[model samples]
Target chain A: MTPAVTGVAVTGVAVALPGAADARALLHPARPGAGPVDPAALIGRKGLRFKDRATQLGLHLAYAALSDAGLLQNGELTVRKDRLGAVVSSNLGNVDTVCRAVETISKESTSALSPMDTPNASSNIIASETAIRYGLRGPNLTVCNGRASGLDAIRWAALMLRTGRADHILVTGVEPDNEVTRRLVDGPMADGGAAVVLSRPAGTRARALLGPVLRTAQPADTAHQLVRQVPGGGLWLSAEDHPVPRSALRNALNSWGELSGALGVVQCAAAAGWFAEGNKSPAYALAGAAGAVLLAPEGTP
Target chain B: MTYPILGTGAVASIGADADAIFDSLCAGRSGLAPLRAFDPSRFNAQQLFEIDDRQTEGIDEPGRATRFLVEAIRQAAEDAGLPEDLAGIPVLVGTGLRELRTLELWWRDGVPLDADGLHFEDALRRHFGAVDTHTFAGACSASLYALALAWDLLELGEAETVVVAGCDVVTESMFGQADRVQFDPPPSVRPFDENRQGTILGEGAAAIVLSRSAPAGRPVRGRLHSVAVNCDAHHQTAPDAAGVEDAVRQAQAQAEVTPADIDLVVLHGTGTPLNDRTEAAVTARVFDSPGPALTGIKSLTGHTSGSAGLLSLIVALRSLERGLVPPIAGLADPLPEAAELRLVAGGPLAAPLRLAQVNSFGFGGVNAVAIVGGAA
Candidate 1:
């Protein structure tokens, strides 16, 4: 189904990977043993003490994305706070804080738990704290919907914008790699943030035009259908392992490491970067074994 | 466009399904009891609304919350006359703490924890053959948030059918946090009561099957007119009256109904002093004096966290169909702020209900309100 609001444009993009300057850097493989940069240096240290790693990365990237979108001036939002929204996706955003709270409760008692750190344990803290930091009074949602979360966040943002809920929405996908996450997963994971400022195309300079996001229960068939929609020499990026054998299909996880919830947004940012660099071919990013979305350069049919 | 409520299922402390729970509510049944999920001696509050073992004998195998979710979904799908394998339908599950209890178990008991099981997608895929699943963790209002998204998907013609569910099992960490936060030990949740202390966490799950059109031979339980969600961005735990007012007004506007059109209001009513005062003020400001009958389900359900909103939605639906609004159990002296509002108490209020509104606010200032009407 076609979305009510068409011409949804990517106004800005931001990336917070180690040794990477912009979203374009995500298209290439990361340097060996590269880790996340210090978030304190990027977003300041005032409210960094009690925040979890994922939230910290989210704040920094949100600020950068808003700035890139020209929505921020002198550290204040240029748009009305109530007209701006935020949608965040993270699989293990507060695992460390939650696990620690559980361990503390099991080992000692509630008295040992710090009241200041209690709010951080809630799963929605990352999205809520972002809204708090940015003064966004609009709708705020958090998606932990497994692999498809990043794309799901984008889809929700698109829906909100098309439905006239918000004029501009900041979609963020972030995940933290810590002792708890390492213990939970068997392989290395991406430990950074990616964000995009999505808006109606009337007043904004479009970096890329977002197409309708397709969600299905059948992954293999949907993947094939999406691949067929792309023209020859077009870009096809996927974070999931599909059976399709197109040589041009780039595995986003192989290049950027295992992003988990950050995969879809990161892939979209990379696609936007590709469009920014004057690539004319259609670009598609697929993930989560359930969804796929198309992106094209501005003015493309 | 309103989406038809094809079917609904609920597993709470009061009853196992929607009809049973609504019946229990009408009969003034209280699910509050001595805390048995964990050691009560470790916490200040000794009561919680835990699901009975008899209700979950064969289903509580994997994780309590996951099992509850699967059972609720199965019930909903079966009631909707859909096959067991929900191939094309998308499942949206919401929770404040998805697997925190299991994580706590793994942390304390050395249980093997598969990272994939942390999210409900794998469990849903394995049990119900649901290939497309989305789990929302937007704190207490998570389920309503899922409902809002599901409504949009149907309204936009993105899908023909969708299942929205919310579940949460109270973890020791959450109970401990509440225990440390509350100054007094409350006997039970007393929403809008003059002596209300704080909220007691509950464990349960609820599901609803929504479709673009009603199925043949199946009763259309209710109509989901509209749902609106917004963030207070005011505080982490505290609620803002203006934010709550905005969400309510937005939902009413989207549903194209005036304040007088609403017959009942299902309050979030966490029973905390601040939440009750704020909610009462917002309700009075939104609706006229002695507005639609106001009732809170958390008094009996004991604040089921993320699932609380869906449970309230189910209550609203049942009230519209049955023409009986359940009273707030254990409510004696209502708050002064609620004087201008009709606080249902002293047994069920029998009235011909049509339009009803359900409110659900959560941590991080997330507020969600849904409007529903009786089947005509």
Candidate 2:
């Protein structure tokens, strides 16, 4: 079945990757950092000392996305609280907390476990933490779809806008570089995230228009199908590290090495930035095994 | 734009199928028993209502949660009379904490970390042939969110059919956490009772196949009217009456129903002092007088975490079909402070039930409410 096509707009975009502190840096990266950057300064030093690393990444990206959308000025939200929804996507959500909780429960008495740190073990707490910190009172949803979480979240947020569920939805994809996730992957995974503000098509910062999000069975063929479907000499942005000799292919996963949940949105945001800078080509992002979304410059059709 | 629920499937402690579970519930059969899945002798509250894994003896899945989910989904799919081609259908599963025992085994045995938390979705995709799969983990209300997502997909015409499932198995890690926090009850789950101590955690799984319209000749179990989810932003562990009340009001508004229209309420009564009291207050606020029949199935199933919400949905559907709302299993005396709302006790209450509301509250102040209508 074809999804209900609505006039959804990409009002703002942001990223929290290594070396690049904000959305602008991700687009214009003079030197990509070799590893994850400590986001303590961006999140401030007062109250977030005990927060999990994933939550810190989520907060930084949420604020940056809202700020880029002009919804936040001086750290205060410009729009009404109830009209803004928050959806956080993650593959390995707060794995550090889970490992810690399990280890604590195994070794020490259950009573001795740190009550403050135990709440962070849950997957939904990341979104809840971001919402509580920023006072976002709209529908808060936490989606986990492995690598495809970011792109799926983008699609879901667009539907939320189309159905008038929220005036503007802040969608984020985040994962932390921790021991648990690292061990699970048998290597170091990048710790970062990407966020975008989805709104009605009539916004001041409408940089790109979202197309249909298609979910195919095979991840191997997703990139090719997505690239072949979009015809008009546009760019194809993807999280795939290597490509098959495609001229319009631009690999964002190389610079931002392997952000599991954050890969798809990062590609989409970077592609939007390229389009904002006079590149009229449509950008297609293939989120591994999940699906793909084709983003075109405003008024492309 | 009404989506008909084609069928419901469950693998709980009481029974393995929806019909048996419904029969057990209506007959006032309690599934509560001492923990058998694991030796809970050393724990604070050494009692739980665990699903009998022997029934699923031939399943090769390593994780208990995965096994239960696969069986439940198969039953639901068969009941829905699904077509041979299963393409273009999205699968949404909700879980809490995952299978802790298996993870611990893998962690301590130095096994390759390939069995990540998202492995369950991969397994479902491979075994069930569902290309579009997603998982939700919002504590006790996770599966409700899964069902809500399926509803949205159907309402938006994103998919013709969607399978929403939820499963979770109690493990030593969970029991240890609860014991450490002193949240375990000594006897049993006595919901809304004056002498309630706490809750006995349990494990189970359930699935519902939702379609835009009912099948050609199959029976429609119920119709999902509306669902609303919200967060309190209050304390992480504490119960918030205001948030629960807000969620109910929003659900009622969306469903276009008032307290007078509600014939029954399936509460998320965890049997804890705070949760029961907060749930009672929210029910009283919604209805000025003694509201519709209020009951909780946690007394029989224990708290199944992720699967609790869908299990409660199954119980509500059963109640609507049988016109009998089951009483609180161990609730001997209702707390006078929470007596403003009618609590089904002693035995099943027979009434012409039409509309029922299901409430599910999880950690981190997450509250979800959904309205379901009986068969037309």
Candidate 3:
């Protein structure tokens, strides 16, 4: 049996989806044909030129999440640099940059490649950039583990807190809808970012307590297993096309479109919002290959 | 909460299996050769550590990286005497450029792109019947990150057994980028050498099977004592000595061992000027004068990128089993800063190895260090 992850609480939540003002908007169905995200409007114009779309989206959400957690004030961190950690998940975060660079190299000479853009080719740029911008000197990790990346990032952050590696961890999942990503996947994609601030439940108001993530190879099995853990009258959120019968189950993918790497975090943000609205039942979020996480409202043992 | 290393596997330019690679290392064979996977005339540096085409002939359809990874996992499972149907065992793969070569080929040759092959989960599911798979892309330190997470899973009782693997293949995009960045790139990689030019990309994969409990009737390869990961939050391309030092200190602290107790140190010597210097400085600050015997395999294997971490760990474990530390393949004149440290060179050094430390630092200031104890 996997040990229960106790004392880790979600203190803050933020999302940068198109047509969504706050996390609560995610609880409702997403607006039809939402316009593309404008990260410049949310964050700023400066430092937006060199960053890729995924990084831009991630930065905006991280800033908002940090502020919501009361850890950031006026663009400055309120906690020690070493006590803060950052983990970002995106399966196709840097695909556009990488594909563009590859195209340039194939068509033009190596000399045509800009040195400034070389760093963006690295997959961990988003996570590292977030840490550098926020002065998060603690353990930084980037998860690109396919569909499970977002939830895996959350699980990794929880382990970091459980092992006393960091007092607080900023977890963000972002995916960009661009020429390359569109070519890779079919159908409209949920191209945005979502972030949650997970920290040890000490001296902080907890919005919800995170339970251990249960994983299985098959999506149907994972959904069934996840549903078995929570009590009755809980709201279940899943992106998989599993046929699990539940009284109050919602497929975020149907409502928000295909979120890819951002689905898990978006589902998590929605659950946190659900709790913030004074709901008492435990909320569950499950992504097909990513497994499931149970979010219990505050004061749950 | 130490996890026992039950089995090991590897596929590199030097050899196909873990034991063969270790033997090649002990014999001081360098895998550096002219790049044959792609046209090398376009790049300033023409040399790389590329695996033989014959080895991946049958399984090179989707990508050579996947081929190497699948081969490595098969070897690891076979070595651990695991069932043919892996059923519920979870797989965690670390990679820098997952299927980028395949994507590049598709773009260049107009081949039909199969999105399923872009990630390792499908391949794992087909090959080993692995249902749960996690692919980490943390650059060069990716596999170590996966290994660290594997350890966490075992420690938390998430799974009794876990498969950790890392793989990457040389892509034209990376080659072109390196050609532009490296100043007068040399044909060979020479770590710790004063004239070390830059890293030569390598293609390969390595895997290790770790278990919470020792496998019944099977000899344990080693015990993973601790793994410490951190970020400099300093630079994207440049490594920070402070971050590297912190990781080394934290690993030693978690393992409850002093520098003197470690018999060997597998340096993440990328052969890049800044990286080697930063690593040497960190080594000097952490250990006493002429610290534990240090060896950099990149001089022979070229920087394997994502798989480099596990390859180094495998070398350390092999050193523990064979009592022979492989020498740095192409080191003649050590950097003046690294002179105080014991940089093994010329030939393999015989020693009664017990504890070994492996360092793997990557782009974006990502750093991971692992300390492993040999089963004597």
Candidate 4:
């Protein structure tokens, strides 16, 4: 069943995946912040090192989101720390750090590994770090629903707003497109980050522009659909009844196959991919894996 | 304000399924047995609420804990009267240490050193199918923490229903660590007894299907009026006697229901020297006159680690249904405070009903108390 809008609205959306060929230019501008470098300007910043690809992507997407909403004012994000919530969702919490730590403690001598980055590998480190970095004191939650991480992040943040937990929530789905996540996930690696600013009722100019927002989860034919994706990633209606859009294929991550959880992240990021839809007439947004979240332009059927 | 419990499931010494297990408890049967599974020959103690070797003739397969989760989810769904499929539901799983038996026995014992804590999602995703989120909270109070999360969601109207579960299985780490801490009992477990030994090792899982709308089919199990969980921040493995009282007070205040409203009380009753004495002291202060009947499951179920809160909750619900309070199996001669409340030894009872409280406080001072009753 669709939740009644109850005056809620989406004000802004942003996405960033550090060094994703495209994010590389955004990550390393010739000048620190000279409006982000273009492909032509990508020449000077080749070896700018980041601690972990996930962190780099997380910061970039968060910044992009802040920029898109014109919420960045003099280096300060618009959302107040007290009224904002953060849900930075990831499948593998700092996979690079986890691999390194495991190798150090279990296989190799404990002294061989720098006991330093161990804390960063913890699951909620990203959420904790994000909250510490920004003064977001609202709900700092870390959600894992496999491929539904991104969509779940959006769903959770939106709920927080609707529940009066926060005025506007910042939801970012981040995972390094690293080799470890790729091998472990066993399918194509989903390496990117996406961010959205979900506002309380009547908080956005988009409130005047949006039609009506609706969210619902289609059932798994079996019992365990959320944690584990279904075969063929759940039943997709080829839509002889409604003409399934080509865009749905790009955003679908319903099954328990490889990257099912990460697919939710991808869909959330791609939903804000305004550039991906040049000729398409329908506006769209999505986040989550198990119970895939479908956010279309206000009035779209 | 009271979110109804639409469905429930459990795994314990009595049985794997809810009906079987609850029936065994009502019958006053003891689930404690020799530690046969995991080759207890190498260990010091030979007692536990082990459910492993029972696979051949009793439970189906995949060990007890995993089976516990699978069956519990199925039963909870059925109990809640939801459609057979799990496509649209949201689930939150709680555990202190997940798949402890798998990691400690398989990963730590024989595997390559780095093979520990492998990708856990494959199994979780496979079992839950279409969950809203997959959360693994490691705190001792993890399961009840999940309950609180589900409760807040339901109250806020974010979702009408949520399936909540807490599970654990016996593991070498659990066995070794528990033994190292000198937390084991002598062949048997005794809570609140003057000559109480230590705790007996136990592992199991419990799941509950909760919704804003109460289910109509089954007799009303119990109403969760209020739940309050607090961290002690005291010593890691011990609880402050005074803090336990505060937790009860917090829950009573939050529910706006007084201690007098409580008709039955389920203590954490860890059976440890400090824990037993503290639980007794706290109960005395909470209910001075006509105190609610006191009962505990540690004797029957051992200690299921983090999963104990929900497990005890299931028993409490069952007690409310039978119109009787089940006995604390191994409690032969009870402590002074324990005797204050009617210890329904020998079998279940039939009256003085209305309200009950279930307490589960874990190491690190993580304390959770759930108050329930007919009016609640």
Candidate 5:
């Protein structure tokens, strides 16, 4: 049975893509290989020196989104910590850490493994670190579903809210550029991430309402379903690594290169930004096979 | 909005089937033995509870962990009486560290690595025809995370049937890492016992089928009442007693039951000094003096990493059905100072079981708890 559409709204969003600081910049690429943003420069340098790039990018986007939502003032959270939950998704979690562990064990002995680096090897530690930093005590999860992870994270967070598990949730996706993932995938790899702060529908500062999400066996079918569900002149953002063909609807790639797990949320943020502007047309962000999310701006017919 | 656990299956070091495994666990049999699949001479720990792939039926491949997962999922679906065509069913799996044995072999002997096997996600798609598949990689707590996600999907009415599974193999990489970090318990594992050293690595797979309603013919084991997930925000390997206590309290409140209603506590019990101590401290603080009987299955099956939590859940449900709690293997002498928890030792204790709680904590401050109420 398909669950009811969550009456949740995406109040604020932030993105840190390659060569782009914000979502608008993300839509318009500047040059070849935007390169990763210096995470320390954006979110301070202390204690972040040894942290993996994934964590740095995730933290940067989350803080930026929360800041945009007015939840953070004077570098402090105005919302209750226990009421906040976080769901972070990534395809290749801390690949650099895993590679480093392999290098260390190869060079010396297994005992030479750094204690600090050992725990970071786990994928979920990125989300855990974020929670620890902000003291968010609500439901915390890390989903690693390859390219579709970002959309799955959003859907899961929405379910948490619908079930009264949390009042607010930070839905995020982050994947860093690394040689290991580069060798595995075919397209241009990039380090980028996007975060969206979701809250109950009755709350203020609503940017867009989260429409029903469709999970089908085929990406094209899911796109068609989204079109039928929200029939209008809206943009269809494809965040998949592979091209999704949908000639019937106005479709476009994320264009910020291949962010893998980070692409889905980035696409959602882009659609939200599109609606945030005067454009009343609804938008849907579709991820790798089976994950698609629709966003309808407030007051949309 | 709770959901019923329709059926369960397992492929562990103890046994391939859940009922046989539970019987062995009740009989106080240990699957811990010397590591044979790989050479563990360099590591401080020389033993592991390794499951022989050759012995595991339906395991076509030789060394890949994917085979174990496939076999386990098939057994679980069959046990649950799921239709043959499971095209759209959601499959949530918890997978541990990447299988690096092929790469390690390539690095050591210059042998060409076999890249034929699929990753965890691909394997699920190919094996079970799962379309909406989500894999969780949270180190040791991976299976618990998967189970929690399955619970949410069922409660939210998003999925009528969800398959939650987890699998990991005893790779050389895991042994090396465990040995380097001093997480290896030499000789054998001893939980909540004085002079306890640490945990031993194990390999296996376990799967459970959950549905919004009960299946026909098969008795409902229990209803997954609530799931509470949190992070310690503390150290990586070491757990904060306060964080664990908070998770327990939150889980109880969500289940709408106090600690007094719990009949058993299935602990993570990695058998490591830090993990056992922290869990004991947390349990003592949360449950009453003669609180829910504390028991652990790791002493018998070893720590199966990603699959440990699901295995614990299977054991707890079986205990609820049989009204008996299995003894904590290798726990000869209970620690006198840590007497706050009523640790179940000696042998299987026959009691009226109703509600069971399972606790799972991973390397990275990830804490997940689930409360299950036995069927009426």
Candidate 6:
């Protein structure tokens, strides 16, 4: 049975990484339509130590979601040992580190490769590091299904939770664009990690409103627009900001400038941005990568 | 809830299926042969349970690891009897190398090699998109972890039937690890015996179709109870002896079966001194009785890396089916520490067994254990 999503909620979500926020300013220049914004040189230096471009953006978005949800406590993020798992999506990881490792592995095969480079090379480094530092010990998966890996990871993470493999789930979709990564993402790319905190249905009014994502079919007409495409087994969707946020799901090209991978981050970005107040019988709908929608709040089902 | 072991098939030098291999193992025959992939030149010792192209022939070309998967999977699928909802089946294939030959050839020689590591997944996806297929690699524990993933999928109801496969073909680069890694003994692999050397690299493919119900094909041999995989975070190559033992106990406990219930044990014997001794000690600690009739397969098959776990389990099942345990092929001298265990040396021995445990511990401290019992 494709279990119906009874409730759609977010609890505590935090972004704790070394250098994600500040590096983003250098990369997230305003596109033609998003209105004029001073480029990185004009933005004040928020210190280089904290921003890994993508992680930095992840921090703000994730922090805002958690803080907005009123779930923030001591900065110390704690999760159940086995029930806590993290799913993070990324289009481009630490490309600088990847390129460095490639050069070193290829040219410096005889010499000892840098231990420092190993962590960054792993596609799931963000999830691994986050869980290690945050004390979460559950299912952890990272996917790089082109730009849609983030959404795909979240979709799977939710399935994990729905299947009772995990209790509270951490879904983070991030894409940090780097110069070296551009070679890989020559078509399009972006920077940021979008995270969502999910829990079991609490049967509250908030559970009644949001409808279940019945099906998330392959991005209908949107698949044709992407510059770089890979046919991996995961769901790939690009989200474009609608004329109004959440007004309707917009394809990547229309949203924020074709958020190829950014669409995955946008799934939660759009969900987290929802200012849905109290509505006891909240309806929830979880759409999959291939247009399979699962409605929640089984009481009605 | 016991996860049914629907159907299993393995491709190795010994035999492609259980019938031929079981007889071979029973007669104390060995499959370990010199490296056939390339010329065995100045390298120290080159023996492995090499696979014949007979198993993977028309399914794939060029004898690549991923192609090995195709071959083994084809047989396993045929053995699985072909479920109606083939689309919903989950394909979980394990590999330590991740098409290492392909990766190496691509990186070093710039030949496209085998695209199975990253591309064949798409083939499975397109063929079985309604079905979920995933690939996992963690050096040696690849298939064991895949087994665990199969269990999780069954438990999670991701699919009613899941195919867990492990495959690896020796690559020149992988062959170099024995020398590159400092711990292995010189050249030869001698498990549980004094003066034991480290593991000799080997490769093959084994796949088991897992499901919630008894498969219509063959009578099931055993049921997979539980699986546990843990990281040492201690070191890259070395085993946290304590971690290994704990993982074993935890997996058994999670399966809710005591060690006393097990009649046989399949060790991840790499034949390295550290491994043999540590595995024996861990077995002593986990098993209620000493060693539980120790059996090692590497002496006959070398080390198949990711496929080792499934390979060993298949051998164990073969032993169970014949109601006799196979001997450890190359134990020259009895190791002092492993003396208590009844080692089936030189040839196969008769034993009534119902339950068993298997281990697959790999580099980067990845460890996995699976407990299988007579079908419920």
Q: TM-score per model for chain B alone?
A: 0.97, 0.93, 0.96, 0.90, 0.93, 0.89
Docking class of 1: medium
Q: What lDDT score belongs to each candidate, Candidate 1 first?
A: 0.83, 0.75, 0.81, 0.57, 0.75, 0.55
Residue lDDT tens for model 2, A18-38:
776554466654364455656
Tens digits of per-residue lDDT, candidate 3, B266-286, equal: 999999889999999999989
> Model 2 over residues B1-376: C-alpha lDDT tens digits?
4578887889888888878877776666767776664434445566777776644432212377878888888888887887533456887888876655456545644433462455366667666777787777777898997887787788787788999999887755566667666763558788999998888778789999989988676798899988887777676678778878888898888889888999999999998988998888878878878679998988888899988999899889989988988888888888875777789988889999999999998887777898999988
Model 2 residue runs over 4 Å out of place are A1-4, A27-35, A220-230, A241-245, A294-301, B27-43, B54-61, B99-101, B111-119, B183-186
Superposed by TM-score, candidate 2 places the C-alpha of residue B333 at a distance from the truth, in angstroms, of 3.1
DockQ score of each predicted structure, in the order shown: 0.65, 0.45, 0.61, 0.07, 0.41, 0.11
Give candidate 1's error at residue A211 in angstroms: 2.0
Winner by TM-score between candidate 4 and candidate 1? 1
- Error at B257, model 6, angstroms: 1.9
State chain A's TM-score for model 4: 0.67
Off by over 4 Å in 5: A1-4, A33-35, A103-108, A239-256, A299-301, B39-42, B54-63, B98-119, B171-174, B183-185
Candidate 1, B146-194: lDDT as tens digits: 9988887787677899999999988777777777777687887899999
Clashing pairs in 5: none
* Model 4 chain A lowest lDDT segment of ten: A230-239
lDDT of 6 by residue, A153-238 (tens): 55555555665656666666666655544444344344454566666553331211122222222444223211112111121223
Which of the predicted structures, 1 or 6, would earn the higher lDDT when compared with the native?
1
| Model 3 regions lying over 4 Å from their true place | A1-5, A32-34, A251-257, A299-301, B54-61
True contacts kept of each: 0.61, 0.36, 0.54, 0.04, 0.42, 0.01
Q: List where candidate 6 sits over 4 angstroms from the true fold.
A: A1-247, A251-270, A273-301, B18-63, B83-85, B112-119, B125-131, B156-158, B170-178, B183-185, B215-218, B273-277, B333-339
**A193-238 per-residue lDDT for model 1 (tens digits):** 6899999753556677777576666667666666555434267677
- The docking category that best describes candidate 4 is incorrect
lDDT of 4 by residue, B1-376 (tens): 6767877888776787777777776776677776655444345666778765464543222334556676777787777777766655667776654543443333223433121133233444466564454454333455665676677678776678888887776644445445434534366777888778878768778888877877565544466777765444344456776657767887788788888888888778877777887888788878876677888888777877767888888778877776767777777777776667556565676776777888987654556788766623
